[model samples]
Target: MRPPDNRRRRFEELYQANHDPVLGYVVRRTANGHDAADILAETFMTAWRRLDDVPAGEKARPWLFGVARRALANHHRGERRHTALTARLASELSAIQRQPREESADMDALAKAFEDLSDGYREVLSLADWEGMSIAEIAVVLGCSANAVRIRLHRARRRLARALSVDPPGRAARARVPEGDSA
Candidate 1:
């Protein structure tokens, strides 16, 4: 029972115990087997590095799942950025194009508000609302306490609501112009 000897055996046991389930989790969510394998490998790599951090018992599975969830998110984010870059390049290269459709003013305002949110607030909201993850699940992914996740979620929702309720900048400025003084 030394640093790595103890750690290695424990990790081997963990990997043997959970590898199939972890693989299945990733494979179910990912589009391709290759990507699933990659994520699975990365997940185990993280577990290897943080072997001491894995929970002592049943919580280990959920903890690994959380790590896999983050790896998947990172993969998707990278894919989306790549796709956006490709689309932008295509749009620039195209000589002829129809005028872009106008989004609703409300949608424009909402998008601006979302963009203005801090990364932590946006991530918390996305995990809670967009991903439909429970508070416990989010806490696992974020490596925080359930109470912390709950508090963060509450604050994020309040911030989003406040952001959504704010008037568009132009309208707010117009409202500030004292009646006749249209400066």
Candidate 2:
């Protein structure tokens, strides 16, 4: 049998080779950078624990991806609980980091607009635009038809446009003008 050190070195070699793809899989499944990093760590930990199951050659990437997918799902479920706890303890940390104090007012307004959107619209935008998933991937994640996703995405864009326009000073004035009324 191979020595323990040899088995470990082999596992390290396989892990190093497949790390990037595994990380990309985690990133795609997660909501943000930090969550992706956590999932990636958990994926490697699983790999280390189950090194014997990892095939030595061509199948390694897929095996790692499968492990990553399961880890990501667990991470997502845990994240929901963590978010609820964190919201009570410290709200808006991520949002505050993304937006400076000067822009906080506009950000707050924009956030309200986003919140006003229907759940379907919000989820579609979050998965497709914010999380950057492909329509096909989003369909799988949301358990919806692809054409349905496309239609919802279109309506969501229109709704967002309307919301933004209504909040803009000039556009708000124009929208309020009566038909055939001169500016």
Candidate 3:
């Protein structure tokens, strides 16, 4: 079915008069022919929807161009949103891929050495390193003086350092592995 003849004719007249100028306006401001065509179509659709708002004669050209300009701006905003989403997704994916590789043999050896520490050394070290507790805070947790917690923390670090020196983290796993061999 067709629109009433008058409405169809009015739309055709409007399109015929303003289409080339609107196309040129969109094309000059757009990145490519495809985007220009899309914006141009949207401009005409807006004009068709708001035919009563469109002016006559010389004013009509500027009015159509304004619609085209707004259409181009909407296209650019959508593109920016898409680009931002893509960048965010790529960063999240890279973080996920990099996490497992960080859980390597060095950390395993360090864990074993940490577990072998005596209870007192483990308590102080775990508070200071793992739990990120300050000496005063560790003292509160362990019911001791801050000065005592500090001394215990120092001795705990020394013991862990000596253990690591004897069986250095990553040394046994990485040593003698041939280049380009994953095993």
Candidate 4:
């Protein structure tokens, strides 16, 4: 294995090689150069910290893109959080009906069903389905054994299916998802 110094040099080389492309990637996705620059700096900093996790040679670009993608997602989530806070403050300051939009009844039911899931089930499902993370990646993120992730994912799906009435309640109860396995 190479020395840590050697690894640092390699990471520096990667930064030199990919910085422009990474910046371009962020710039195209972001609204302004300032946000792009922030994302660019964050992406490289993450790469620097996780140098060993970065794939070698041809795969590095895509890996860096993935990192940037996560950063962008986090950025958007923060924006949404701020927006939600403002909305909440506005709601507190006034009297509004806050009527639900004209969503389909089925959509409402699905949303309720998803909301009814336990936090653990919801998280695993979101990470797997919404975030498009692989089982191994989910395992890494959740800090659990891969088999445990698979088991929880399986259980979460079954519970969600039951909630949505896609799976029979009898089976959902009978299978009995182990409470011990949580992300």
Question: Against the hidden reference, what TM-scores do the models get?
Answer: 0.49, 0.43, 0.53, 0.47
lDDT of 3 by residue, 58-173 (tens): 89999998888788889999999999999999998786667776665566678888999999999998888878988899999999999999788877777787887853334456
> How do the residues 32-148 of candidate 2 rate in per-residue lDDT, one tens digit apiece?
999889888888888888888888798988988888888877877887898898885565677676777768877777788899999989999999887899999989988989999
* Local accuracy of candidate 4 as per-residue lDDT tens digits, 14-88: 999999998888988888898889899899999988998999998999999999999999988888999999998
The candidate 4 region of ten consecutive residues with least summed lDDT is 95-104
Off by over 4 Å in 3: 101-183
Off by over 4 Å in 2: 1-3, 84-183
Best candidate according to TM-score: 3
Predicted candidate 1, C-alpha RMSD: 11.6
The clash count of every prediction, one per candidate, is 0, 0, 0, 0
Sort by TM-score, top down from the best: 3, 1, 4, 2
Candidate 2 Cα lDDT to native: 0.82
Write down the lDDT of every candidate, Cα atoms only. Answer: 0.86, 0.82, 0.85, 0.86
User: In model 1, which regions exceed 4 Å deviation?
Assistant: 1-3, 95-183
Error of 1 at 60 (Å): 0.7
Give the Cα-based TM-score of candidate 2 against the true structure: 0.43
Candidate 4 runs further than 4 Å off: 1-3, 94-183
Clashing pairs in 1: none
Per-residue C-alpha lDDT of model 1 across residues 5-61, encoded as one tens digit per residue? 878899999999999999999999898999999999999999999988999889999
